[model samples]
Target: MTDQSTPLAPRQRISPVSRVAEIVTSSPVVLIASIILLVVVLTALFAPWLVPHDPVRLTPSVRLKPPSETYWLGTDAYGRDLFSRILMGGRVSLVVGVAAAIFAVFFGLILGLFAGYIRWIDAVLMRMVDGLMAIPSILLAIAIVSLWGATIWTVLIAITIPEVPRVVRLVRSLVLSAREEPYVEAAIAAGSSTALIMRRHLVPNTIAPLIIQGTYICASAILTEAILSFLGAGINPSTPSWGNIMAEGRIYFQINPGIVLWPGLVVSVAILSINLLGDAVRDALDPRMAKRGIER
Candidate 1:
């Protein structure tokens, strides 16, 4: 005596991507961070048009001038325009940060997927990651750069190495957990192959966390590049990097405080912008919070 009139499956829920967008739009912090990040990225991409002067030019006559009408944000010890250098330096920082994070993420994803998929290989790869992690990232980068010689490629490789392990750890764990789920079990029971399962199902689920990690890594990479430059291990002097500017300022810290103050200000703002973007992204990607539509 079954109810023959009605036999129905439950409705499919809203997709997470759509839900995430809706929730993100509701958040003012996310809105502001997104806007600021966009502005910063665009400024970096268009530095030549926006900046008022050549970043690396020297003018001993105008050296250490205070912020004024002609030389806005004043000039450095060599009289290069401070604002122009900051703008130009941002372009380099953005390129390094994004390029390193993306390279690390790509390398990690490939390694992580392999490790997560194959049992015996997982132990070996994770151990290697562990060995790399045991060393302080900054020290490891300096050692590699010293051996390879200081160049943009060397800097990119050095910055990316530490972050790869982090991404691998996150992705591998997520894949392992998802592999045991009921949907995965169902797929395994069906005619689907392992490659199909991983490609079709596993990678998509892990993307949310990967995005969050990428933002954090971008912040870390930028900070690391700045520190390396400060320590004389970064870009060539002619490049006019913020870190280089800071390094130059160190000598004039006592007499001309603007030297340190302006460079430090730009670095802080850049790092802060990245961190804020990360926070907003983390909130948006939080599965529990996203599902509930609760502001967390």
Candidate 2:
């Protein structure tokens, strides 16, 4: 007989398929969001191939046609295929949103780390952030875009600037809490450089919050882009973006509601999916909630 104190054989490693299945089952919200995101991304990627008609190709004869077997989602005032325009529009909206979020988060992270870690400049940095926060983000974005001109890069830059302050505040808060941990103090006591302490210790603690914030930034960027486009201060009208689609269609909204309806639906779905997934991620990463989840 084996010794009673001896540990049992190592548990069998989970197969890759089983691991994937487990993740899907455990996080249904994430799975749903992932599917929606994948579809939107793929649609944007394959817009040219997926589109039944050239989105920009104007057909005078078909202008304002209602949803039908031929046009599917119908035609806009310029007689551009709504379906194709919707698919192609996603490319600009998603690209600008995702790009702006990435830039905002990156810039914010660096500034936040500096402000939180270096006591000398904390007050100054926080004051600057507060100043930016005091301004209405949308109004500020519109002003920037109006000054810069309605171009893709301008809109991206405009969107990124307003989002940076939010990210900076989030990262700074995390760094403040993490710096007081015993491990961090011990690292300092062991002659670790400030950079090393921040890189190895503080940075790791901010990941969960950063991920959650990034999703929020992404959703906010999308909405902001749409708002700017609607106001004629974002991307050029020639560029197919969801906001532009709705803006152009609103003129003939009474005659052809599908033009605005389809793009609006896509935007709503995308933002909702991201928010749901963000909540799920936040719940999963927070230790306080982990025990409650298991108990349930």
Error of 1 at 141 (Å): 0.7
lDDT of 2 by residue, 1-296 (tens): 97779777874544434543444457877688778988998999899899999999989999998889999998999889999999999999999878987899899999999998998788899999999999999999988888988899989998999899999999999999989999999999999998999899999888878878988899889999998988888899998999999999888888888878899999999998878767766766666665554455
User: Can you write out model 1's per-residue Cα lDDT over 1-296, one digit (the tens) per residue?
Assistant: 87678768775565556654664577777666667778878888899999998887788999988889998888888988988998888888888999998998899988998888789989899999999999999999999889998887898899999889999999999999988899988998997997898888898988888888898899888889989888988877678777888888889787677777887887777777778767766766776766566433
Provide C-alpha RMSD values for all models, in order: 3.4, 3.0
* TM-score (all chains, Cα) for each model: 0.89, 0.91
Model 2 misses residue 289 by how many Å? Answer: 3.1
Off by over 4 Å in 1: 1-28, 189-191, 294-296
In terms of TM-score, the best-performing candidate is 2
Per candidate, the number of residue pairs that clash is 0, 0
